[model samples]
Target: MIDLGALAKITKAFKVIDNDKSTNRLSHAYLIVCQDAENLEGYMRYFAKQLLCSESVPCESCRHCSLINSNAHQDVFFYPTSEKGILTEDINAIISESYVRPIESEKKVFVLSNAQTMNAVTQNKLLKTLEEPPKNVYILIGTTSEQAILPTVKSRVKKVEISPFSKTVLINALIDQCKDREKLENAVACSDGTLGKTLALYQDQNLKNVIDLGIEILTKMQSSKDVLEYSTKIIKNKTDLDQFFDVLDMLLRDTLVKECGDQSLITNPNALNQLQNANFKNGALISIISAVTDARKRKQFNANQNMLIEWLLFKILEEKFRWQKL
Candidate 1:
């Protein structure tokens, strides 16, 4: 279980929900949208404890909280027990079971994890129950994609948007988990505000190698002739290619910041010397950033990996030399 107390955003959210419950204004249904699905599920369980616990503030030591923490609660139901995600059958089960009285607590909590996986048909099936659930029944739907949910379904539930943590909050939360300060900073820089991705990047042993390759490309691959060799070294696999692109994009942006004489805004502070020595002008950095964005888009659309890498490298070199000649 995630230490929800350590997460600032989640702690704030808990207070908001607690306030609602205190004022007797709790919504019957809530739609929580978060990019980090795994952590979202853990949060939902904690939310369940918030609703079911005997104490005004959830005493994690209580029977309700302990049952929820252990995933042994009789009243709290988590859907998509299989990797198949929330299906029509799961919706049917929820609907049928929601009408039943709670055995352990006054309120029955149903959580649908990965709610985005439910297509139009499944969502439509869930629309009625979502609109008017049984008395003392609370439903929580979590999705990474908010746009995928039907407008009617969205309208019925209170939308809870979980924003990414600030640099300070994330760093504080991860301090004890990761002892390496430099690697932790690098992971946080690349995390884009999501804790799951931050932890994944922090634990990734190959991340340093990927960053080194990105630096090599930016500082050493000066000529168009170097594209092929660099491309081969960068494109080990799709995942590695994506990581390389992230590092390259980050480094280029940091170099642009350095060029603008704003050292404070640089994400890769440890690479300051390299960024300082990088001779690429503002125009070149901007062009390279655009190329990286385009390349990432192409990658998503299943573009030929080799050709895409080659094209991106050529564009980077072209922009670098073009601006230098000016």
Candidate 2:
């Protein structure tokens, strides 16, 4: 059930593949970069269909399209089947199997998911196949960050960056699923043009609550004594911490925009007045934003959640006070 119409409206990644096919200049290796991990697989599948489908475009009714959609296509292979990610051994296996002919279709497509997970050694192992790919074979690598890939491997692949959906496009696609207009608007505003995040925010019943908590912290939380109280309320678990950080980041960014007298550019219109009244200095806001980013990096390395929350709050409060005196 690949919704070609919806995907076409949301992204242009497939169109790039289609154009390549129509012109008969299809690259042997393609690097698909998308920030939304949830929809990356769907993009990869569409790319595969464009290459294998007998029709000028993916008809969805063709055997190649059906097999690809169902993950039953023998000629189409997806690698790093485990959660451990792409390893040197997986690269070796791909190199070994790539020379074999396609089982059904005229072309073979090997999708390497999470290409960023392939360290220098593993990526190096993949270079030979990329350099001298078998006839009619395609290597499609999907990654969230292209910078993580080595330049040597990158130069050989045709890189396609997935664009974010426009607000109107996202609204049209999600309107049927979400009846709450206010919630839908909020989700779209906070999604940063990605459909996956918009859907997650729309379904989160606690989104409004989290946002309110973030506003309260920015406008009301004062002195070191309030840090523990806010931390307890915001950091019940890792998921809660992430949600809090996202909300806080958005609010801070909006506040900074407002402080700079650019009301039209702020994302959260509903919170504009609250942000305007917060009266945070630009220096303090910038420092707090940097602190939040540092906290997120620490969280990725298995940092203690409670300590991280407390430290982040302290930094915010200290900046608030220091900037107020100046």
Candidate 3:
């Protein structure tokens, strides 16, 4: 069995679960939700190992341990989104697997990663399975947000919150992944306390490049030509466009903070002077924030990327130009 010694919150949660198991009062299902999807994987694995272990502590050397380690355990089922992420078929398979008897272990463990991706219909289908969980079975539904889960389903399962990691923890995790200084800082700022995203940015060189471009676009709000040129880079990558917007928003927020003289919270300390010089009044800042938010929403509905860029750039230019003229 893997020991959950690294994460303090996880260990504490495990203690509660362990107490219940010892008292013969284990819950049928659990819902682990967090903003950081990466942490959820380790916590889930540790919990699954404990459930599958024959001893009080999972002996990582046992036969069951070998199966779990080798991922040969007949009873432990894991479901996640394929290339497209969670789908209806994935949910159906979980429902089907729940009925199967354990091949060797005393109990079965079902792990549903990104359970928040379940649509309304799939969620309803899973609710039925939760209502009547099989004997000697445990279901773990992993989600980024409890709100994504249906209210009925959320009510059925016990909830555990996994908070996002601190910037220091995220930075240490990114050390192996980040090579460029700009990418490192941008990833740390954009991850919003999620180590998984930071590592992903490190591994996916393209994403790091996009974030670097995003920073350039936001920080260099000098000329109208510069604005249009940089905005185009952000609009080019459809995949990372959402994250690009997040970075842009953060940059604007930092500029706002600097304008308001809140230097303590500035992430881009090196660019604070430039940000202060470009700072808009509260009204202009709010307007631009709203515009960026709308642009993000437009992205969700297959909005035209080029026109979206034109719209946002024009909006900002109009606001800033108007402010300068006044």
Candidate 4:
């Protein structure tokens, strides 16, 4: 069950949904937009419970809410798809079953995950339902990229944008799970401000280890004559390269924040000693920050990961020394 308490990002969306339920104007289809697709499904399921609750709206005490929370509700249909995404057969089944009357509740909600993977053909098939949905049925589509969904499908559904929480907001939400203030802060930094990503990094020991190693390499890069030497070994360790870059981003961001006299705002405030005495000035720090942003953005286009890592590291070194030879 998703803790509705932590869903601060989409509180307004909840209000709108609640209003629709009260006024009996609930839309038949909804599109949830989020940067993290997996977590987006949680939000969708919670909304389904709200829409289908029997005893009271979103009342956890209701049997309908209980069944849905456990993912056993007959009225709530969830599409099972992971990295490969939804297929044609899945769409066909949904289209076939969408019109069925609800078994236990007044509404039947079809929750689909990773809408981006649905090819044009499958999406076109599903469009029939969205165009003319059943009276007692609702469809929830979750996707990280709204652009990936057919624009026609997008037009028929209510749009809910899930924004990433700020560092303060995220820490307040996760402080109970992690008592250590420093660990919590690091978790927030490494998570890029998403609650799901923060919890995942916090729970994964290997990701935590990579974060420490990435930070070590970053410290070495600050003073080492051969920054590329450290960066080369990291690029070689391809197993946890994604988490490594996330940590690396934090390190560079901390450096920039320190140079700008805002160390208090950085993720690793404990590293103030190292950040304060770093050799690079504001210009170099900004260049490194920009480079990290570019690398992250290019990841979506399936850029060469190894070469991209190598390129960003070299860019950091070049920027760091560009001002020193004067």
Candidates 2 and 3 compared: the better one by lDDT is 2
Q: Rank the candidates by lDDT, best first.
A: 1, 2, 4, 3
Q: Can you write out model 1's per-residue Cα lDDT over 217-258, one digit (the tens) per residue? A: 778887767998888766664447788788888888888777
Predicted structure with the largest TM-score when compared to the true one: 1
lDDT of 4: 0.74
Task: Give the whole-model CA lDDT for all candidates, comma-separated.
Answer: 0.83, 0.82, 0.70, 0.74
Candidate 2 RMSD to the correct structure: 4.0
Model 4 regions lying over 4 Å from their true place: 1-5, 8-12, 54-57, 81-85, 206-225, 235-239, 258-264, 294-314, 324-326
Model 4 TM-score, all chains together: 0.80
Q: Give the TM-score of candidate 3.
A: 0.68
Model 4 residue pairs with clashes: none
For model 2, where is the 10-residue window of minimal lDDT? 1-10
The Cα error of candidate 1 at residue 303, in Å, is 2.4
Tens-digit lDDT track of model 2 for 1-326: 32534664235666777788888999999998888777777777777887898786678888998998899999998877889999998888888788888889789889988888899999998998999998988999999888999999999999887887766777777887788987887787678677788888999888888787788888888877889988887666334777777777888887888777657666677865665567689999999999999999999998988899999999988998899899
Instruction: Name the best candidate (by lDDT).
Output: 1
